[model samples]
Target: MVSPVAVPGGAVLGSAFAWGHGVNLRRLKYFVKIVDIGSLTQAAEVLFIAQPALSQQLATLEGEVRQQLLVRTKRGVTPTEAGKVLYRHAQIILRQCEQARVDMEAAGEGLSGQVSVGLAPGTAASALSLPLLRTVRARHPGILLYLNENYGTTLSELIMNGRMDLAVLYGDKAIHGLSFLPLLKEPLFLVGPRAMPAPAQPVKLADLRDIELFLPRPYNVVRKLVDAAFVRAGMVPRVVAEIESAFTLTAAIADGLGATILPASMAREVVAACGAWQFQIVDPVIEAPLALCQSDHLPLSEPAQAVKSILLELVVDLAGTFAATPEPELAALS
Candidate 1:
């Protein structure tokens, strides 16, 4: 029998044949797959193993952990409380195992592996997608970069599950399993069509009360900030529609449908591309917070670390340029 091997996070991996004493990687994989599919028979079909064999493996796993991990029902199987906890750890463990293999294979050679980075929509980081892709390609040809543009909450969930390596998203709120590195505080701007007369000065929160607006759903980080500001001012915004896609929002704005509030960088880009205009918000200026987020418990692989370094460098460069530009300069561009 193979000896028990200690992995990161103080977890032990031993032979699957160790039976009632130790849980092995293969069994953990089976358990995770079964939970993910929510059916043992289906999992067996997908795993190309007999149903009885998969059931036996799960029994052995439960015995090793001394916990009931699943509940069977007519609908499907669901993880028990203990199973839920184990499922989270199992995801991290599997991801670490894969990373270990990649690290070992690339040892002594230059860094090379796939790194998945998420950039939340409606934030300045979303604009970095192309730049990041180009930079990674130029710097590390061996690295495969996967960029996901999504909502902050979705990206954070992926990071917590160990499915994504890192993300640049709005919000500095403390999440349980994630760590945030605050990048910059971006002032919000009121962006609208050029057909509408541009404001000579910064617009106030109360001033936007009558203006029809196109905003993301209430759950969005930017939307929450805007809503809180409105509530503080004792005013209700006139929201014509809830739009999540930047393209769709911009299209609506270009069609003279409504205005939108966005961070400075994203606002600038939107106005420049759609022939729109933007002015900063005032009378209690609202700012959206941006941060780099990663798993608090898991370690980054070499490729991920390298990509993160490059991301930081790019953020610094972008922020410096943005900071140097004054409101007057922004107005001129608008």
Candidate 2:
């Protein structure tokens, strides 16, 4: 048999399989390595096995499982739906095996492993990220923790794509092949430059008709909510700029470009970074629900499960404080 060519990541697995036969650990390891490296030839070289031999093993495994685990193309390989399912299970199995070994080696020591989590910018700003990291670092000194901050939509995509083990997302937007645990409901706030006087009272979404605003694209969860409210209020949102970066949005607002809507906690952070700003509760009392989300198909490793538990406890503690106060103290914010 000829050596299979190099395949890039995301190459589609074009075949189907009947899930009947059991897969061996050796086959699983080979399959996972190929999926991770995105190239059969590269995985074979790394495994110190002949390309043809590796290919034969993969073919045999596929035959036993009766599934096409990967789609091969000139550019690279992509996992099919079935392949993705197998890849997730395989990852958990492999990780558990490694973690078992590590635990054995560190028997008397402490838990030692790696956990990577993604967080949306708002969730990160809600006074969760730093505390989570600090607590994990302090308590599980041996556990390696990685944090990736991005938009809620992006974070969900990362979690689904297997790039992130888990993420805190907004609105519980239904994402396919994922599970969610509701965390908290955060009240929304309108943030504007410090130079702008505080609104006399809580501003209504309808009141924003004439105001210039800087917001993320419509696809963004926050923006989508804001847009829906505007539509409900029969107001035409006067968006002056479409900025995807949270940092850029804050900078623009500070420069007096326009105001934006965000969770009260996140708005406070923006005000602190961008200069003086008015943080007003929306009249209709808009609230964004956040949740801890994970892939339904991907099993959480022990370390990841530990981190998730820690995160849940921390969010409960913090959210309780926010819940006690409908509106954060505006005076103290300034």
TM-score of each: 0.86, 0.78
Report model 1's TM-score to 2 decimal places.
Answer: 0.86
Compared with the true structure, what per-residue lDDT tens digits does model 1 show for residues 49-89? Answer: 99999999999888766778899999889999778777877
Question: Which lDDT value does model 1 have at 14?
Answer: 32
- lDDT for model 2, please: 0.73
RMSD, each candidate, Å?
A: 5.6, 7.0
The per-residue C-alpha lDDT of model 1 at residue 175 equals 85
- Worst lDDT window (10 residues) for model 2? 325-334
